[model samples]
Target: MLSWLAEQRIQEAMRNGEFADLPGHGKPLELEDLSGVPEELRMSFKIMKNAGILPEELTLRAECVTLEELLAACRNSGNANSSEQKSLESKLSLKRLRLQQLLRERGLENSSIFTEYGDQIRQRLSGQE
Candidate 1:
């Protein structure tokens, strides 16, 4: 009953042009890949994402990427500033350590798949993939 009333309201709004000229009105929606997320948790993940929340592992990985980029810039610039490079290296190391601890807490650190391709997985998580 409520759905029917909602649909009628939506139809009335459409007829009134309330949905016209909206952003991305005619564009394809950019859907996120949820294959990695378990079916039972997909809706919760989507709701969190819509609310601008990210899982801690993802957040740590993003920080690692940014730190790596800064370190690369420091090295490639040929300035060879040891302090700045060391600082970035230290930060990257700490973030990686924290990420590893998180994965260990989740029991993924000892998984055979993770052990076999840990570097590759880290690279992918850091957006190198």
Candidate 2:
């Protein structure tokens, strides 16, 4: 009932030209590029972005960068135990895979980072142990 009343008021206002002469009245709305957002989450993410929130995939990408840094540190550390270093490397590889999956889900399968990480993983699997 309230929605009907509100819509009626909006229609009346439109009839009165209340929305006319507004900014961009004769122009098309400038829409943001949401091609990287998943179809189901696109609307939710738009609202979240309007409220100054980052999307989950972006946060996951940040985590991937941190993990990559930690893995590099382990690789360069003389005092790091081989087993511990290997564990961190494994975790980093898994995180990269997860990030790639997220990117693929969001229609970013062609993203450079995804391609790079995916290629690395494939190359590692194809190499002789």
Q: Which candidate should be chosen as best, given lDDT against the real structure? A: 1
Query: Candidates' TM-scores?
Result: 0.67, 0.45
Query: Which pairs of residues collide in candidate 2?
Result: none
The C-alpha RMSD in Å for every predicted model, in order, reads: 4.1, 10.7
What are the per-model numbers of colliding residue pairs?
A: 0, 0
Error of 1 at 44 (Å): 2.9
- 10 residues in a row with least lDDT, candidate 2: 120-129
Best by TM-score: 1
Q: Write down the worst ten-residue block by lDDT for model 1.
A: 112-121
Q: What are the Cα lDDT values of the candidates?
A: 0.79, 0.70
Candidate 1 stretches greater than 4 Å from native: 1-18, 38-41, 110-129
Task: Quote the lDDT for 40 in model 2.
Answer: 66
**Native-referenced Cα lDDT, model 2:** 0.70
Instruction: Give residue 69's lDDT in candidate 2 (0 to 100).
Output: 68
lDDT of 1: 0.79
31-119 in candidate 2: lDDT tens per residue? Answer: 88666444566788789989999766565565666666677787788887788777877877787788778777877778665455445
